[model samples]
Target: MKRVASTLHQGALLGLLCIPVAQAATGDAGSDAGTQASPTLKAVTVTATRREESLQKVPVAVTVLDGETLERDNRNNVSSIVQEIPTLNYRPSASNKDSSLFVRGIGTISTSPGVEPSVATVVDGVVYARPGQSTLDLLDVDRIEVLRGPQGTLFGKNASAGVLNIVTRDIPEQTHGYVDYAHYGGGDENRLRFGIGGRLSDTLKGSLTTSVGRYDGNVENVTNGHEVNGYERKGVRGKLEFQPRDDLKLTLIGDYSDGENDTPSVVVKPSAAVAAGISPVVPGNSNRKISSDYKTYVDDRNQGLSLQADWSLANDFTLTSITAWRGWNNSQYQDNDNLAALPVTAVHDKGTVDYDQLSQEVRLTSPKGQFVEYVLGTYLFHGKSDETYRRLSVTNSVGNTGVADYSATNDSYAVFGESTFNFRSDLRGIFGLRYTLDQIEYDHRRVSTSAVEVNSIRPSYASSGSHTDSGISGRVGLQYDLSDNLTSYITYSRGYKGPAYNVYFNMQATDVQPLDPETSNTWEVGLKSSAWSNRLTANLALFHSKYENYQANFYDVVGTSVVTRLINAGSVTSQGVELDYALQATRQLKLSGSLAYTQARIDQFACPSGAAASCDINGKPLPFTPDWKSFVRADYDIPLDNGLDVELGTDYSWQSKVQYSLDQNPNSEEGAYGIWNASVGLADYSKGWRVALVGKNLADKAYAPVLSTGTSTTRIVPRDDRRYFGVQLHKDF
Candidate 1:
């Protein structure tokens, strides 16, 4: 075995080089140690953990996608981001404007406005509660980190599955700014993203960035008597930083997004409709006439404001606090079918949410002679969320006839403590515990107006619920440093998620109880190493998790007016292996790839199991669980005379077919498919300006990014298989 330096040390050495010439000329001790620097690998990331650690040295399994890579790939939407991360998948629903996200094998399939997501997305420290906001385009983001596995102890709330943290670029103390513009040949895809930032004073800085994208619909609306197609979107984000002193810092951020999606609808198949006991859509009717025009066009808007502060109490301790408020509104139509046979359903949603969360934490480390390093924190969260869903039944494309309203309010407080002991030089033990008390008040009201009924029925109910759950979660790991660069460790932790309010379209009986929170236990072991003259870095980890009483949506055999309800299933177990490797073949050549093999299934699940002899799911793979998925990306830049450079790169992903529906429909599985993307560009690396030609779906592979199983009509978006060539220009001032 060869001695390898830790990934953190390697990054620190690289940062010290500064263009490789100064250190080379000085013959510094750091420069004499190893591998030559590479120009293609200039981006740096620090989202591996709460700490500011280098991407390569982070102990956890993470994927880094910088803004430059996002631009070069011409990936301006959420769909494009998922293509590079094979372990992620999503499904579209009427409840969510965009598709609901799923990582590994856990995610919500029901787009019901009431169902909460299992995964958590954190922007700068503020947790985005709604699924619609998760897909918002990247905005002045410094880096995006996708942390795999349960992160409840650190991220809190719905992070039982994982966490997607978007870290925006901080305001630099120097004057700098950038503007970008791009144009696509197909669908007239046009985009503009620009931002400016500068130091107003030695202790004050601010930045503002805005992005807008629009395009004409590629599909024509033959029945609407006009071209019913394409989409338009606009987004803006701004931030300001105040640092009155070197030891304290306060930051404020605000963001807004509004967009319209004109994506066409996929027709429902006859078999699926018959299975759901719904009549097929009549032929010769436009999608709008059959399912309503709203489904064809999605109108979405969101706004967020947050504040973060950090105070360095002492050299061995620090204090931090975060507060935020967020709101989301979405109005969309779902064309249940391409034909007009069935009635069209139009839905309008109005939601307002305000959260006031205050967290106080003090981290103290061992001083010169101390042996105990500890962390203590107290958190208080107050939230009031009111959501109203208006569902209208349109006949001959008429107005709304009925409306459904759902709302909830929640208050939570917790106190937690953790401490690490240096039992030995080669072994460290971590122990932590947290106690939480949460109160929730739920109100559900539904009103219907029809010619058959002279006066509409107003059914309303309210409930006051409180639950106190106390649990202990901790990690025990042993790290044996064989050398300065090589280390290995094993850890185990148990985490729990608190139950949340479930909003139902129809009123529920007072006797019925809401779903309980989920509990999970995870065991993992991993190794990190860097070798081969410091040009190659490899990381591997294996983990197994077991969850009890998982919440799932199912139809009630005895219910009326409502189609689905939430219930807890017995148990589920998941296990997987992950591997990542990055190698610098040469100073200008680089290669990086990641592989994940996962097995997620219902260990003992018992659904309604409708009375069908052939329908048996005793031991079957869970829905939407892709067994094998991998990503490979490589790029090389060739420097030429003068200040010009040419860079070429490509990446590919292969996903195995997985079940898409809980009904176990054989046709619901999406078959294995591979997508290839390539890009070429010329730029001056020394200066901050560049031009690039990017192409997505170079092979024009037609595939459904998300297969919609809403109701009887199962429509699949025949993803645009046409090649889209685009040019991008960027300048920094």
Candidate 2:
């Protein structure tokens, strides 16, 4: 604790020192007369509070990335975006079907089909219930807003940690279109992306986007002289918007993606005792390579369709409805033993999931200039999902296999209202509340084909159950406009997540138990300022959150097999501070930076069923929770006498070390690392043509994104995309 305090103190001092430098460059104290007009900062508007408002006045901790910034940073996917967000982390497991997203150390480790993610992801006002669905490629995005801390009052359930809101480009009124193409090389990788959009008619518009990419594996298989982790993927998305009436709008979207790749290459690092009997493989010694005798592969397919409608009503109100359906299928083959000598054990697993959801919301809003501006709304959601999993294992010419099928039906309803009271010109009070009810029905069946003796010990099982839960979440805050250029706010909020069933059930029916709900309370304070004639903007937030009945997933050894189970752990606490700044130093140069510090620890916890020992983890930091993270970015543009523009930009980011597992195993630790990227571009706006050259990981830093420890060996997933350069071209018509 003392070390963390010291680090925070030092950071604070550094930030204070920067103020003078900024003042010296921009003359901060010369504005007393208010005679010289200053350039107004670009207005930033967001819908984080369920209504459109200025980001500086929303009284929430939110980070907004505009389309131009995203393109400049090469954040075309969720995984890549995590590199710039201080509080976000994306860790993909070996299966590749599940992606764990941690926000401020409060995130779900389980990837079960039935479990809900703590951090909710919403695109174009439609929530994606599955984490895998949130990993889709980003295309034609207008803006993205990341709201930190609990946001249950407005975003609905499964938002105990935070929320990721993505807004795609909307149809324009004019008949215009654009085409873009990009090619990437080096590191034995290639990617191509293109898109076109335009108004189809006076009241109709549409867009189509597609991308195809391939990467030759960097790791070599010594046994076969072939790449072990090479893969290719392609995706296409189409959207149509119809505006039949001035007050009504409708949109239709369809998308599909397919990918095939070799199973991830995993290097085994056995303990000394375990290595005495077997050979140990070091990562860097052999160019971080590995050898597998089995010819393993993974195939994945995803498709989705959605429809949204919005209608403007009288009294400044609106009505919205969203209907969506999605499907996923994945198959994998692997050598479980991870040895080249012989295939002592091999496994094949396949899963398919189908989901459909319908949601409706109606909101009423009062005028903004009134003494009290209020918003009231009611929400309804209904969803159904079905999943099937099949696994086969072979050893010593004998095979063991099992098939588990699961299904779930869910219905949820909520009523919420929020109001802001303007006591005076510079002071305001805000309060909001939401009451939610959720009901879920689940069913599971498992069948196995094995010897009679094995079947007797682990027979087929079936179970069916239902659960209903209700909760209340709310927020209270106060905002004070210190001056025309500055504002400060403090808030307290509560968040909730509903109960869920264990989706990976393969044992006796009795072993399939439902986990309880989880809740969090957070307190936060923030400051937002625009200074130096709007050339500089800064935002800072400090927060603390306490959680109860935190849902956790762990491996449980039942009889002779291992299975994942969800349980309600006791308590946890997280405290953090975030800082963001943007400066338009001059007409040609722009700079931006962000920094974060977090201390998340388990307040109380007990070992689960399959733990190495029954020990307490009281004070241990959460997995993947780094203590410090920072980023710096700069962009400069130069105009030539020939009406051409040349732009140069760069980004650098770094993070502290982090543990990979709940046990905090020393062997599962990943060291801190930094990455640098740069780009150069030329544009002729009058001719509607532009081209750019981009490079990533220019320093060629090597690191591991994920690591895990097994009974006898440790598995590490290394990121080998050391360096890559790409070219992009765009044309408008």
Candidate 3:
């Protein structure tokens, strides 16, 4: 029955991807409205506010990536693409479709399948509930915005840390479309995609996009007796626009994706060996499966629909509405170990989540000429999330105990606002606030196979908790125009993270205790400059953050389950400095590089059991955080005749050591490593067509992005370390 459901879901996902993009409506009038406009080194962005503004004029710290950059890097997946961005990291896991993300050394690490991500991802206007589902294939991307500070006022829930806003191209007012195809050698891979957009009438426009990709697993699965860790992905999306009047605009967007693949089930190597009656290999070096009886497999399906509307009732008053619905199902089974050299056991885990969200916002702003240039808004957001999970343990030495199940239903809402006043043009200040309410309920049960009856080890717990935390998270920024090409600024701000249901629920079921809410206050100062004929640009920032009521999670001594808890953790401090520089050495050559250095630690934290005088990580660096990281890229365009173009570009990223576990396992620490990526392309922008040869991770470096804690070191999710040569072709018609 389970297999049948998975098969059906996979088929539906594939069917969506197979739709032809050209069949979609394409009669829009504004599709080419700005194509002939003068281009600049920076683009205008609107996610920070409800209105469009130039990036340089925005007072926030942000990272922007345009469509050209995404295609040049050949990063179709969000998880894979974020690795190139500084201060962002993803931890790979087989049981979940989405990886975990850490920003500025803070994030959640859990396989519970029901917890909300600390970082939030917004596509179009909808806020995705889970990271895995939020990372589906991106189609018709216009721009991506990464806001680095706390966005409590604008983004609300899960914006405790930061926000990632993704905007897709609105259906062009004019007729236009593109078809792209790529072939990758060494991985038996191929990818094809096409999209079209245009106005159906003066009041309506629409677009359709679809893509499919196939690739072989890089790992050789000796246990399965064939390759078992590669995958295939297919996805499709549709969008429509309706403008009934000059003051009202509405958009509807829908997307779906399905994937089928084989993956190695991860397990504790030493435990697997003991269960299989095999000798244990040295920690970290040993490759052993926890289960050998069954092979690991994965089936993932995702779908979402969103509605957005903008209504400008008056010259300075506007209202916005965003409604979202998303569903996801992820299933997996594995031998639980990367190596089959020794006897092993296998485990099976499956889960599903369905989510719905509704958000409404109304803003009142002053006309441009007013000295009181301000933005005042009130927002209400509500989301309902449901999740179900099941786990089964099977091994040669241990028999299956049927399956254990856990389910949760979460409902949450928030109201927030922000406003700015230009005391003077050069000295502007802002203030913001947010009020929130969330309720989470859980259902846990165990099934007995012999009698087919369900028994409850724990009674169903339904509790409603409310927290009204109001903080002034705003910035005081002063911009000084030193010259026509140079600008500098110094800014200071405060941020916070609201309490979560996960803390309380985790405490009810685990030995680790839960504590109060976690919060942080940060201060930052920065300088920006552009000089030398707009060919040279440099930015530097120094920041310090103080964390209080820090949250911590650890495993029980038996290591069978994770315990949720918190501590005052005294007060930890993180101070960092960063420098980004870009220089145009010549008209045909450009060099850019960025360097980052951060030191984070726990000033005071008690032991898990509260008995030990000395602990594993009292003053050591936080886990999964690198101390020093840097990136460099160079692009050179060769001079050619007859309108031909030849361009070459390469980038390199490296990081210092990072702790993998709280136990302070030296063997599990990640060492400094680097990968080389390069691309070569042809054709001129004036023709609207180009082709490129690209290679990623050219060195094929072997490393693990994440590891689990246990009595013994085990469960390493290895990074893809294979080289692929691919050809990319894109054309606009």
Candidate 4:
């Protein structure tokens, strides 16, 4: 492989982030490295191992996105950042309720109240129980750490796939704040945000941040005379810090957000029956125009409260505790038929969800540079959710209408610890383990029905069940120092996810069984190097993982209705190679990029005895697991005699073709494509004022992240699916 340099900040995403020319990332080699003659990257901090450490010192494969990168990306939700990540992908739906995440081709695709996500999302040490919670717009984010591979020992939840760890900025010690505003063309987007923080006394401080934003969608809606797939959102976040004693510190954080999203999939490849009545509203299918009888909308609210305390014990060890509560509510209405006017009376489709969770974690950490440094902790969690889904039959003239209401609860307990042994100064060994117990239960009932629904609806029937499971997950690894600034390591880990129940509205007799726990074992080897006096940095890793009883969704036809049921696949495997590189090419320029090659596939379907002929899907690529993916970026800086500086940057991201259907449906495949973005900014650091003009998809490339052929050949349109321009203004006080 050819060796190249890349900055440590991969967060700029397909070019959403900026890797400064004169700056690298992680710890500073020396003050001289920052000189104009030989500029070096500065220190970047992270807590991937449950402790504050330099990014380069961490053993895990991690991607860091700094605060500045997010500001420039101007993409608010979590999905915006996944676009260009090496081996990371997301599952898109019409609403957050069906959103999911994938890593190395492993992810969950079910919305059952009893099914937990494979990829876990953590915000300041608090896990978001549902995948949708992580989709909310971020506020005052300090950084985001995307950890590839399993993180089961320390996190000790359903983090069998990977983890997206988000860290919010801390309260400022001095009285200061910032204001940001942006206006965009094409979609008529306008956004404004304000943040202020200060110290009230020697022992107390607080900060507040508020934001509001709205945009017209890129997709045209002819029936409603309003653009669909648009966004309207408002949110606020607050934080308080108190240090009554030198040994103790307490922090309280609260946040709330409300959003309205108009999302309705459009038929990219219309079926024979649905294409005859359509007329051209937009030029072509790629123009992203749709016609629906009833306006489709998804409204949601999310709020949370957390209290964290850190105490420095007299014995030199640190003790910490975090208590948190979070809640999310969502309601949605969609045009199920997805046609302007069809004989199907499927317009009365709706869904509602109310979910809440409470959790507590207490941990103790030993001081560094000891014979045995370790972190020990205990975790407890409780969650409850209620859902109601009502839909009119697509074949209303020949089908029926009904409502399904269900509720579920999940409880977990675990004890976990990790230790690093310094066998020698240059060589170390790390081992960790976690013991977890999970309990899940659900109650579902079908109450109302019209048109004398068929046997699939199961009206007037109620059922309830519970399940319990336990497992041990852990990791073992070794690190060897080859040189002063280079290290090599190999690790083996076992990860696990809890069992699940299919608790959807259409309660059938065969759907009452609980799924088995999902498990994976992985082996990875990597090299971390920052050579040539800290001007060049490169990290490389190769990993292979085997998963058993992988949870997935399977469609079964019954009486003119396609029911989506949860099941376990026999076996699967994911093996990949990843590279992150950055280099300070010159004092005025920098070059950076990341690349990955992945082969994720199904080894066996574990088909049934008789009709197993259809299960010959062995060797098929997993959904969203592209074989090749890469991102490249360049940045340049110039200084003028007027005490001002200018920054220019550009980036491009591309990936090979991948199937979006688990069943290997050809209509759900998206071919290879790439996107380009550019930005120009002028800044005056002394006065803390800046202005920038940003353009995304400059080539006007058209692509979709998700597609479905079950009902119709439909595609979900995303923001930035087309060319758009925005200008941003910022001021600091």
Candidate 5:
């Protein structure tokens, strides 16, 4: 309690100190602005509803961030962006191929190839089928929109929770380029990014972007006398746009990314019995250091190509086609025991997944002056993936190995339509619907062998199966314009996720089974207001969702080994309230904040048979769902006499206690924590140059991002980059 109080006090003091400086600067500059008008907040446009519209007029609960804001705040990746959004959470897996993301208490916990993410990740207009692809580096991005609700009707399948839409920068007709460099304090961490765009001919334009980044590990391996968890990545992207006529356009995009890093290190927090038998804990070991007997590593490669075409037809009709091919290959090795003792247990996983997708969409949009505006669209998608997995567990006396080859294909078709009826000048009724059909087929084969262990040997197994399902999802809403500055809406929506298969390969192949599909129904009420002459914007949303046939990952102790399997739980419920506000206090000062309260629980669930332990988990909080989250940010600009400006900014975020596993054991809980970050910079926009110094986790707080429960011990992955400072420089031409 005392610590929390102290941190809050510090944050308040910082805010107080910065506000007066901004006020004084504004007062002094008023003398020269006699004829100038006060600044107002600019209108933000988003495509969250599948059409370009003003954010303030949209009826959905959404958050939008432009490229300028992201660059100014030094948010370089998806994980960092989650901190600013109150309703989102991100956790890195043991390997880069299986990160976890949760929105509104609904997400995917399993990293198997067969399982799909609940929150759809859409780049441009194409959805990434695998979560690993969503973790790619952000480069040349124009804007990002986070929609916090079921988006099944417009986004198609696998959108039960929400949607993350990313729009990349397009090729410009004029020639332009920029370069950026950043260097971090401690252990020589650095990054570089460059981009160029120009027109090759009257009808042809192209743009190219590339980035290279490297960071030293923050964790030290005491046993091996080496650093662990370091990372290096390289990426390149190219885009070409061709315009044969005024109403027809075509775009081609290709990208390649390669990254290698040390596997995430685990710090053991054993039970009382296990702790008593081991040596005394080292002083100052904390979560930043580990003692491991074996080495850990990961290597990943990804590449993709996409072609998009759009054509305008008569009477406001449009046709669109997208074709894409993406592939991922990864190899990972980890020291599972997380100890320096002999007879250690280690694991190696190597797999490759190749995906090809083709989609076509056609929409007929009614004119704006009509009493009823409507849009009708049809979509078709087909994708196929081939995956090969090899896992090895080695000990002093025996080596256990398992190899699996799997292939899957999916075909989805949907017809969707939405319309808005203007009953009055200030009232509107919105309705939408989508009918979808999905067909999936899979084939799997696995073989296991063990040396020096007669009982561990198992026969080779092969299986093939197919399934088909269909469903209807839709949305209904009513929006009222209360005034020029305030708008309110109420909505109800339904969403769905397709069925999946268990892809884990092991000696006990008999335990695997196909999992059922999941569905969700959500109701939301929201209010959006712009006050103080459009200088302040505030939004509030209250939502409730019920899920049926919830898919979950279960861990069971089979004989002497632990196995993971997918199952369909009975039901789950989630309710939450979210608030977001932004204020332009003055021409040179800006403030923004968000707060969310979520209560997500499993209404009914029963443990499956043939497991080491069996019990009911009724009325338990879902995994990775925090009770409360809040964030606040302040930015102030100080004008200088020489056409230069100094910018000062600070932000603070807090999250309540969270459960890392479904079991809800006391050891799996993480206590509440807060983080603070600050930055100072000097910029001259006319000259296209800027320099900034940024600091993160100024209080040097220690926390764990993930916790794993083993057979007898619990391991935690600590959040890296503690109390670090960095300098960033940017140049443009």
Candidate 6:
């Protein structure tokens, strides 16, 4: 049955992608009131190569989202933004700290703090050690660049899978400000955002942005009268600049945020509950409801400061320096059992984390337009964090299982350089390399505090360990201009990640040893083209990657209880084809679409210690990765005689069924689903004011993004679990 569903979904994806660009090329008008000339698509600029360049000319796979487009799409944060991007995925967890990012089905799921994320996020000039920090409600962002594949040489700190380069808005030359408000009816969600920027002095400028919002939640908790899955969040971001000379400029950035939200979602499946001797909820219920005795919540706070300096040197060379410090603290309470009435085997968990990091980077770049251009830099980072977890469970009887405390520290140093050789007017060769050394240490201890006896997930133990390692990674590629508006490129890259430790609450004697480092080798071929007199743009990329010592989760079946532990898998492989295109069909109409077909699977499996005979998952597809995904977006506007513009936009995103568990349990699969969002607005360009009505999940689709099954099944129902409507108002001064 599932296979049949998958086949149908695959057809839908292809049907959507293979039909659009051809019709758009005919220059069809969105409005019948006009005989206007066809408009050319605007040229896009990107910093994917750490330098400003035309998007179509860069020899890499990158998707650029500008500020205006983001606002029009109603995407406020990283999670929402990933939904429309090809091969990009986000996983929410019981707590923000456990959430993760993945590109091309390649990412790490462990929350050990001892392993670095395969994909990294860089905001302005600062790199966030934790990807969860990227969720901090970014303020007044100028643009976001998603660079796919290994960017080790230029990005440096273990971006083996991909990089999310975020650039915030710059200070305005003249005083300016804006305000925006939005209200959603279905979830009873409200959002208010405002920003101000201008010149502060003859040689200085400044800007400030703030966002505040709240939601009543969509899910109902039957155990308690109160609604569950709600959130209240607020944040502030500001920046300042000083220009002592025309050749030198310095900028300082600061931001802070605090919020309290419930668990990602702990709704129990009805069939799973009944099978375990409980009531209410089917395996695929569409009620958007949950049953939990204990309330779940996560209180989080984050703040950061960064300083960047740019100085032009002799011979048109430029030097850059960035220094930053960031901190994140959060506490989580979870109703792990996900049952209205406590069963014989139920569990409750509480955890807290305190983390901070400081980093400094200096780089030098050669002048552009030269025969050979190069970027050389050195990066240093130090991160430290401590965690505490406590749990209570019932098995035959109730017992306060244990309290686990753990701390970890990471230090990294690297020097990287990338150079492009312009061999001819239309041909270029790229070469890059990076060398890094990493040192990590951790200490963990667990103890039971119960009168009922020594009861817990794992035996209480104390352990401490440290590891040090070093490696080199680089890339080689070639770019050629096939025509004035067409380009082709091919590249091969090697990615590296340092050794890791399984430093979690359940620290056993056997886990004292560290896991080996993970690495990958990837190859990519791509073509970028623009046609219809530069009114239509199309790009395609094909990539394949093989990874060794893949960091993943394996299970240990001990006395009828399955305990999960982090380990190094033998091998894994991911390959995919990505297609992106945009067409300016008319002066008032624009069309854009993307499609991705990814095949991610385990090539070799490593069984848990002492569980060899029971483990066999070698050819299984990776979790959270769908076989096919695609999206289509359209926007149109009609200008009135009085200078007002009426705008209409719609976007549809779809994905094939996805598995949410590493153990490959069929019960943990989410069926293929599609979300359709639409909006209509009226705006006065001269007055800088606008109003709009937005509809999300217009078809009332129901789906879960995350799922976990133990004594009971728990899953995360996304924010767009049902149809919702919103009103948006904006003004500028």
- Model with the higher TM-score, candidate 1 or 2: 2
Instruction: Look at candidate 4 and give me any clashing residue pairs.
Output: 5-581, 5-582, 6-581, 6-582, 6-583, 7-582, 12-17, 24-41, 26-43
lDDT of 6 by residue, 26-47 (tens): 5542444233354788898988
Off by over 4 Å in 6: 1-38, 268-283, 342-345, 450-456, 557-561, 610-614
Cα lDDT tens digits for candidate 4, 437-521: 9999999988756535453454556889999999889999998876656677899999989999988877666778898999999
Residues 362-387 of candidate 5 have per-residue lDDT tens digits of: 55666665678877777777777777
Per-candidate TM vs. native? Answer: 0.84, 0.90, 0.83, 0.93, 0.90, 0.93
Clashes of 1: 11
Clash list (residue pairs), candidate 6: 270-281, 270-282
RMSD of each: 7.1, 3.7, 11.4, 4.5, 5.2, 3.9
Poorest 10 consecutive residues by lDDT, candidate 6: 27-36
In model 1, where do residues sit more than 4 Å from their true spots?
A: 1-47, 77-79, 94-98, 111-115, 156-158, 225-230, 263-265, 271-295, 341-375, 394-400, 417-426, 450-474, 555-563, 608-615, 710-713, 716-721
Task: Enumerate clash totals for all models, in the order shown.
Answer: 11, 0, 21, 9, 0, 2
Encode model 1's per-residue lDDT on 1-733: one tens digit a residue: 1124234434533432232333334544243345445322343557444556565544466776676677667666555577677566666543344366777777655443334567778888777766677766778876678877766545544366777787888887788888898988766878898889989887889999999988764445444434344568899998989999987889988899988775555443444433333223342111221233333556777788877787877654657677777777666664433333434323333333322233333223233224555555665655555555554444445544445565665655666655556676645555556666656666666666653321112233344444444444444555454444444566676756566545654444621355577777878776665554455566666788888877655544321121444556557777887666676777677888766767877776655332221235545666667877778889887989997889898888777777775545664667777888788888885798889988877887656554433344343443244567888888888
Query: Which regions in candidate 5 have their CA more than 4 angstroms from the true location?
Result: 1-36, 271-285, 340-348, 450-460, 507-513, 612-614, 712-721
Query: How much is the lDDT of residue 87 in candidate 3?
Result: 63
lDDT of 6 at 398: 52
Residue 180, candidate 5: Cα error in Å is 0.5
Identify the superior model by TM-score, candidate 1 or candidate 6. 6
Query: For model 3, what is the alpha-carbon lDDT of residue 701?
Result: 72
- In Å, residue 178's CA in model 6 sits off its true spot by 0.3
Score candidate 4 by lDDT. Answer: 0.82
